[model samples]
Target: MKLLLLRNFVFTILQSGTVVGLIPFLIVEPKLNDMLTQQLKISHYLGMLIFTLGFFMMLICIRSFAIDGKGTLSPADPTKRLVIKGLYKFSRNPMYIGVLTILMGETIFFKSYQLLIYLLLIFIAFNIFIILVEEPRLRRDFGKEYLDYCKKVERWG
Candidate 1:
């Protein structure tokens, strides 16, 4: 059990960290001077708060995946059971929402048009992937239970 959780955590970090961490850092280029000045701005604080909240949201979703679903966020190591607990109770794709929220926070914090564009692009891509790929797979995998859950929960939160 510990080994599986560790594996899930590692995969979540690698996959989500690359998307929400490494890519944003490349776009942000957070220098000390600019960072110092930005600290005083309201947008900076707001962004930090949103980012922190989004990070926590992702962590909770990851925990749900590991504990309830017995898997990680990676498709290669997907949940054996459908995750309909935690944030999942409210939204079918809370994890994806968490990723988008993080991107939004980054765009706001950095005040970068490029980051905004990236966020928008990722949003569209996530929608497409969920509709065409993930949803169908979930339906096929979990059948009636997943469909019933879908009926009970909104796709996004």
Candidate 2:
């Protein structure tokens, strides 16, 4: 159980780091100094708070997936059981929400227009992926249970 959790945590770190770390750093870091002007001071604090919240939310959701659903967030090893507890009870796609929140926080913190564009693109892509691919697959796999969960839960929160 410990090993499985460790593995899941590693995967989460890798996935989150790539999406919320490396990409934004590469794209936004160059303009960071200029962006972090005196005027945007409040934004910096707000962004950090949002980012921290998102990070913790993701961790909680990931742990719930591993413990309750018996799987990781990776598509290669998605949760076997439907995760309907924790943040999942509130949002059908809290992980995505978490990621998007992190990205939005990054955009605000860095004051990067380019990162904002990237965030929009990612949001659209995630929406399409969830609607077209994930929902259908979940419907097929979990049948009525997933549909019922959808009825109760908001897709984003």
Candidate 3:
């Protein structure tokens, strides 16, 4: 119970902090690419839309894996059950992919290199969290089931 609490606390703080940090950076820098260029571009909006779609896909994956039980927090428990449908079929870490997509979308929308830097930091932090905390918990909880899943799905896909 205590370990679950600690895991939730740490992940929440890290996720919230990265998102909060991104907001101000996005706001201050408006559509820079538009201002710099005389003509508008279709590709920019298309890219943003694609990222938004990916973000929602990640949300769906998270929802599908959610445990109604109190003991589980991180969706790292393979014993909790396997989620192979929807976005889970495509990527093991849809939530992280969604997070990355949001960051990428922000970078595209705001046209800010600063937000890109923040996105890189977010990636690094998430990578550490997955490696140190999430993976070990999954291995402990799910054992062979998770190992098999790992073999099938790429970590960051």
Candidate 4:
């Protein structure tokens, strides 16, 4: 129990720190709208539009998929039910994809190298969480059932 709590705490700290670290870079630091080209605002808007569409799809998929399977946002302790419907049918990690898309959108909008790097760090953390914390637990709990699901579903789509 203590180990689980510690792990959860550490995950929380990393996630919170990533956000806090990005806040200054996104809001306080002024970046040229576009360093490479003069059309920074146009690119920003384009990125925002693409991100918004992806985010919206993710939200819809989450509601349609996650709630049915009783999945939790955290990988620390997940529900017993295996979710392989809706977005899960398409992508094993829609929520993470959504989050990463948002981060990428922010990076494009802000044109901040620092925030982009932070976003990459967050992706690394999430990748580790999925590989180390989530998948093993699922394999342990679900066994052949999960293996079958894995056979059908791709990790990301």
Which is the leading candidate under TM-score? 1
Model 1 lDDT, residue 4, Cα: 79
Question: Which residues of candidate 1, in runs, are more than 4 Å off?
Answer: 30-33, 36-39
In candidate 2, what are the lDDT values of residues 21-70, reduced to their tens digit?
A: 99999997777677765575888988998898888888888898889989
How should the candidates be ordered by lDDT, best one leading? Answer: 2, 1, 4, 3
Where does candidate 3 stray beyond 4 Å? 1-44, 67-79
lDDT of 2 at 156: 85
TM-score-best of 1 and 2: 1
Give Cα-based local distance difference scores for all models: 0.86, 0.87, 0.63, 0.66
Query: Candidate 3, residues 1-157: lDDT per residue as tens digits?
Result: 5665555455544554347344635553475455547454674686578667766765465456553223322544322665555676677777677777767876776566777787798789889988998889777877897788898888876
- Compare candidates 1 and 3 on TM-score and give the better one: 1
Give the lDDT of residue 64 in candidate 2.
Answer: 89
Q: After best superposition, candidate 4 residue 88: deviation in angstroms?
A: 0.9
- Candidate 4, residue 22: lDDT: 49
Q: For model 1, state the Cα shift of residue 142 in Å.
A: 0.3
List the candidate 2 regions with Cα displacement exceeding 4 Å. 33-40
Per-model TM-score, in order, reads: 0.93, 0.91, 0.67, 0.70
Deviation of model 1 at 137, angstroms: 1.1
Number of backbone clashes in candidate 4: 0
Which residue pairs clash within candidate 1?
none
- Among residues 3 or more apart in sequence or in different chains, the pairs in candidate 4 whose N, CA or C atoms overlap within 3 Å are none
Task: Report the C-alpha lDDT of model 1 over 31-144, residue by residue, as the tens digit.
Answer: 535865743578977888888888889989988988999988888888999999889988999888888888888887878888899898888989998999999999999999
Deviation in angstroms for 73 in model 3? 6.9
